[model samples]
Target: MAGTLKVGLIGCGNVVDYGHRPALLALKDVELVALADITPARRLIGKAWFRLRERQLYADYRQLLALPEVEAVVVAVPQKFRPRIVLDAFAAGKHVLSEKPLSNVPAVAAQLVAAARHSGLQLAMTHNYHFLPEYQKLKQLLSQGLIGAVRVLTLHFLGVIDYPGAAEYQADWRHTLAAGGGVLMDMIHAVYLAEWLAGAPAQQVMAFVDALQYAGREPVIEDLALLQIAFPRAYAAIHMGWGAGVGGLDISGSDGHIRLRYKQHQSGGFNQPIELYSVDSDWRRSDHAIPNLDTHEANIARSFTQLWADFRDAIREGRAPIAPAAAGARALEIVLGAYASAVCGRVISLPLAAADPVYQKGIAGIAELEAWAGSKTKAAGLFGLRA
Candidate 1:
């Protein structure tokens, strides 16, 4: 607790190996003290990769949480399992940095937020995109009035799930309603980025969803979800999908506009470019490509490291967490509202109450819904056999 903050890590999935482990290791102020994983194979991989001693391994996260030296926890568990682990960490008197999308349901997310607040522990959400240098520079420019009163924001985020040939690979727990999968939850990075750049919470939202390309897959969750949000001084639109396409954002303001495009490769690399246009000189344009900076994966690791550094500083100062618990919950609310709007065929407003039909029915005790989704999916020939 004095020189290096002892860190306990939960979950040893691909994200932990690629992102969290490297990030935590890079920070001099932090030490990876303990790790927990349900899978022995994963725990072994983490232990071997990080050179952790055998005594630091645990199959149950509660044991890790009980470590007196652990001042904080980095929760990299799957989205569905996060809420419980986060709450437990707080109850054990440890701060938390949870992976994105918060949890599978808004109700569960709310409980996590409440627990963090009550325990007076910092709760930060990993929204690495917001910490990208280009994004920060852009935000600084906008705050300096370079764009002069924003008016509109638009984004297109689409990707293909390279899930071999198994139905479970594509329509597994993550895609089920109970697990809070589908386009809305899986592709919500755009929603978080938009709200952050727009500098305001979405006041109202309207959405349209459909089972566009993956009709053969089971589970009625939509493959495409188009969302529109009306903010106080700006309006925003997002097109999310699971098809083979990619695009980025275009923000138009009274005086200028900014554009970005992202390309993902099967070879595990990415190309991204950000451009700016100003109306002052007949809409003159200037653009720059984000340097790959040693593989896109490394860039993500660096970003995550920066994110955790900010969280550490916030915890030390007794200030708000880098990405506060409320912000994480609010992001979930926006995604849930979008889904509710699509299902109910109407616009949905913010600050949803516990009595809202969507909250009561759509997200309430999702295990039942997951089971139903699994059955419906299996019956619908999601396993790739035609009935």
Candidate 2:
């Protein structure tokens, strides 16, 4: 509505404080107009931290959206509530930038996409890992045919879901499936990366999910999931867990191979390093580790800032957002397909229908797991096996 993009942020949670707030503040073209959270303390904290006028704080998101000055809304709420907020923001004639795993469920994600499309508003899902320097370099290499024809992508991302020093309250919400807890949500970066590298649609998926070991706390969701996705051109595998472990991604192609290794911690500081092996005169290897580089955290912030800028540009230009709502819906579909395959003991095809038994069973299983996990005190391992 004005020369500067007026941004209203919803959900002043850990992510908002650590990631989005600083990044948005750094962007010159954007103004942080308002903030909304269910908790009064969080709203107060954000207002104090950002030095916003008292009137800019609201307890309800609907009230935030009703503000004429708020041209765009960033839905950084928990994954379970993302779909509703995204749809509502679009309906309110505001562009939306949502945190990852667009929705906890696929069906709701699809509805949100449809609503955004019909309303002709921007909807962007923040998958920040793709913007990392290493990833960007890898993409450039692949596009330039340095890796030749991509044949396989393997990603192993594992870390302790409940580590020491983490807030007890944070664990409470994360341990529940209703709050979108799982290796699925935690390790979704790998899934999206694999799909991005493969440059092909995921055709089918087969997954084995279990509630393996946790850090002395019951996980209301599957802590470990091994997913095998068959894309049109290449096959991919993702091994994700929430226990003591180390993980990375390996991409093998016709002529070269690249590996990115890191210790998985949810917050940041897991840059790891990238190793490349290429066929030249002889097989040569090189490591491109930046000196004292905190690429992971920097990339996360940069991705959000760039994503917000792109949303504003799209709106001003009357064009679709960089990662449109449909793409977000498709990403959720791919994730749901993996879950369905794990539940039904079969490969689930793409474009899943509403009447599919696997989808029904998947939802039921998630619900049951959540209920069972909440009542247990000890860390519940994978649903079917050890992590």
Candidate 3:
């Protein structure tokens, strides 16, 4: 709390470039002291990016964890590989800042949360979307009752860019079964945002999961996810996919409505926001100006920096970060619930039962659940279901 925070980084993946790299470099009180990657090329890339000595680089993350200098670590590996590393970090007596989706399996995610809770160490999520300029402005307006109590929220991320992972590892790992669900799981920022904006945990979910982008390629995942989530007093519809489609945010409140559109209709975080406005009950429109309307990349970089600062202060002040591991676990369950809704053609309840197959095994559980004969998810051959 009094001095700089020494941090270690695991997995030198592409996310580190725009997200963690800037934060580690920009935050004066945070220092990225050690780097670890299974790939030599990625290790070299991280070494150059962080300017670490050869001794500070490691092929095995355990070696980095053994370093007593590291007070915390940022785990940037794929979801499937995150649990062990995070659990190990807790065992090593270090706080952890894990990448999104926490883990591919709900059971594993719960274990990680329990581990962090037992260790009394900080376990924050890389849910930097909470700090994005547009979303921050949106939250502020909603909090001020600019449109009265929210009744319905819609987030369109159909234009999500399908960026590949580090070439050193499997570049298209996101397209594989091990990555979990698909577009919905990949862009889980929208899922948690729905909960945060609604001011309540999700109560139920219904969805249509398909693979329009890779339909004929024998795809194992869905590129398209249309979800309808129900909260106690509000509902949210999230339309997401992997190709160029609609992109924006719309909110309907008791007194008015709010809208946000991105430049060139690209998804948020991919392009700058071009317009944000609200309409009152009288049909009068009031435009809101987004501060620091810099390049989308710059805004993303800043969000991560702010998130890192929050993680640092949370550890020092003995509090939870803006996005904690429990939030990540909840978000993951929401996505998995959407998948189950698609497969079963029914509204799946929230905080899925521990005995539920989806709760036990993530996307893989889809194959075990009773499938609806006419379900589009099954028709599309997603989750190992045959047409």
Best by TM-score: 3
Return the TM-score for candidate 1, rounded to 2 decimals.
Answer: 0.87
lDDT of 1 by residue, 205-322 (tens): 8876656587766544667778999887888998777764666667788887876655442111133333433443257776644443444567778878888888888888888865
Candidate 1 lDDT score relative to the true structure: 0.72
The residue-by-residue lDDT of candidate 3 on 117-215, one tens digit each, is 999999999999999999999999999999999999999999999999998889999989989977888899999999999999999999989899887
Which of candidates 1 and 3 reaches a greater TM-score?
3
Candidate 2: segments with Cα more than 4 A from true spot: 160-171, 215-218, 263-269, 274-282, 286-295, 357-362, 365-387
The runs of at least 3 residues in candidate 3 whose Cα sits more than 4 Å from the true structure, single-residue gaps closed, are: none
- Model 2 lDDT, full chain set: 0.69
Q: For candidate 2, list the clashing residue pairs, or say none.
A: 210-382, 210-383, 211-381, 211-382, 211-383, 212-381, 212-382, 213-381, 217-379
Error of 2 at 84 (Å): 2.3
| Model 1 ranges with Cα > 4 A deviation | 160-171, 263-270, 274-281, 288-294, 360-387
RMSD of 3: 0.8
